[model samples]
Target: MPNITGFLFLLLLLATEGSLGNSKNEVSHGSSQNVVGRPLGNSLNAWKYCQLGWSTYERRCFRFFKTALQWIYAEAECLRYGGNLASVHSANEYAFLKKLIHQGAGSAVKTWIGGHDAVKEGIWLWSDGSYMNFRAWNSGDNQPDNYKKNEHCLEMNHGAVQLWNDSPCYELKPFICVKK
Candidate 1:
């Protein structure tokens, strides 16, 4: 009889904990709420990827371009696909991209992101001309240092642990694109 009561109590606790976890996830991943019914891909299968590649925590579809290109070219390529260069908004999104890049292109690989200060020095902006409020700049004493006064494009995963670095916009490098 006592064993039955203990088992019932354990079950109740488990259910309560599960509910709490789900609630927290929902609140944390509010962007995914609208993606519940979206199809992963089209019927033709022409696109290389589908909705499954989107991170639920970030609420954006990401694609990595293995080819290296200048910042302007990279941004143009992304725009052709109805998206812009990948703009990371949160730490979770950054971490997700870091892992994804490592899995897709190997670690220590530098990839062009959407951040740039081309318009004016010291004022960073995303590809869509949005102000950059979130930052994961490398504090390694040489990053965003604008070495030689020509570094304006933002590159991630340049150093260990996916830190952001400023590089010349003309430098060719692999890039990631993001679509809504």
Candidate 2:
């Protein structure tokens, strides 16, 4: 379930973003109107927001790239954009990401994320160095069993259901990048 605060914040962000005038995404952080029946002039608007084609949440910006690329190549592309290949710390984040991709692709497709255990077996870490405290691994038999011990990268399955699965880094897939 989505948090009420987060849901309200999303609505506020959308409403604010939709009202983008000639200035675009660089407006100073402040509220010209109340958000969710309360002033949103708090710390929530204190940081710089996202750029064009990016979505902002809690001051972070995320963009979904439709180009399919290998995991390493995808990470490189994300780096070029001044960010990482994206990391998920909670179910809310995971859901938000899935929704982000769906808004881009309009269909289910395996997408690369920033998780891997390349350094050691069973030791997963986000490419951006975020803590790997959440796992949405597909609940399939022997899922992410390091199939043939060659799968070290992570991909999210977004469809009627969303879940994570391990795959080889060489696999090409579209990816999401997060500017923290």
Candidate 3:
């Protein structure tokens, strides 16, 4: 039938295209086993060069670390991987990250983000040195409470949905890392 022939042709075309990789970038199923020997066209091409377990969204690759570590140590580890702690620039990004954390780490686990007031009390900033133009802090009188003047690192998944809280940087917690 013509339909069967057309489908076979389409498959052939896809196989050819996959064999000839694009110069821009190749998107794969996020694992070497899926990508290493396969033709580029065989991939879904979601985002170029995204490693396995790393989610690609908005031209960035995000990976959530389940290992608990101090805020400073977490930042260092992200840097080692050629990225930094995840920074939220928009509500959509925040929401995406919130879902990612909850799905990857769980809703009950507290996780450290990039925001911190370590340089100065009450002056929160992201690890990338960006000022806080967006606010998602927890409800009043509790967060950024600077308990004993020591709580300075920012974290999410505190009690309510996606609220943030200020805790001491020394506390060990899982973190999110981002790469572009």
Candidate 4:
């Protein structure tokens, strides 16, 4: 009977410790607080802000657009909505964006991603303060066509699925942006 009691006590202690560890991790991960009337750190938080749009899982915001636009205009629009164009950092993010695009959320036109070659004519950067690591450009695109010299904007053509083309900064198109 003494051994049985000791075993029960050990199990209880372990259960308690596990729960405590989960709570601590949640708090430290910056996902314990609710934002914009939605619970944080869940997929629902992504959909709660906008209708069927792209969501930044870590920062907590949904990006929306109906068409494509110039990089400058897209950035400005995101600012107006308290966010910026979506910056994809992982393969999961790339897949998610691709799925969103395929779902007709952005079916009409090629949308502007958050990347640009604006810094030094060839160096690409995302809007989220990260260096470009992954690219999804189309064939023969982003080849520095040198059409206008120093053109620095990027767009994802849905048809080609791997094309990224550069265009003038002033031309209007749809874009994605993120915000907290």
Instruction: Pick the TM-score winner.
Output: 2
lDDT of 4 by residue, 1-180 (tens): 999999999999999878965442232233433333334465543433322334545545656576556678788788777677777766666666665555656353566777777777777787767767776655554454535685577766545554466666667776667676
**What's the candidate order when arranged by decreasing lDDT?**
2, 3, 1, 4
- What is the C-alpha local distance difference test score of each model? 0.78, 0.81, 0.79, 0.63
Candidate 4 to native Cα RMSD, angstroms: 9.8
Off by over 4 Å in 2: 1-45, 158-160
User: Model 3: how large is the Cα RMSD against the reference?
Assistant: 9.3
Clashes of each: 0, 0, 1, 15
lDDT of 1 by residue, 1-180 (tens): 999999999999999878965442233334443323232334432223224444433335787888899999999999987789998888877888887777778765899999998888878889976567689998874678889999999999876656999999999999988887
lDDT of 1: 0.78
Off by over 4 Å in 1: 1-57
Q: Report RMSD (Å) for each prediction in the order shown.
A: 14.0, 13.5, 9.3, 9.8
lDDT of 3 at 158: 75
Give the clashing pairs for model 1.
Answer: none
TM-score of each: 0.68, 0.74, 0.72, 0.60
- How accurate locally is residue 67 in candidate 3, as Cα lDDT from 0 to 100? 95
Which 10 successive residues of model 1 have the least lDDT summed? 41-50
The better candidate by lDDT, 1 or 4, is 1
Better of 2 and 3 by TM-score: 2
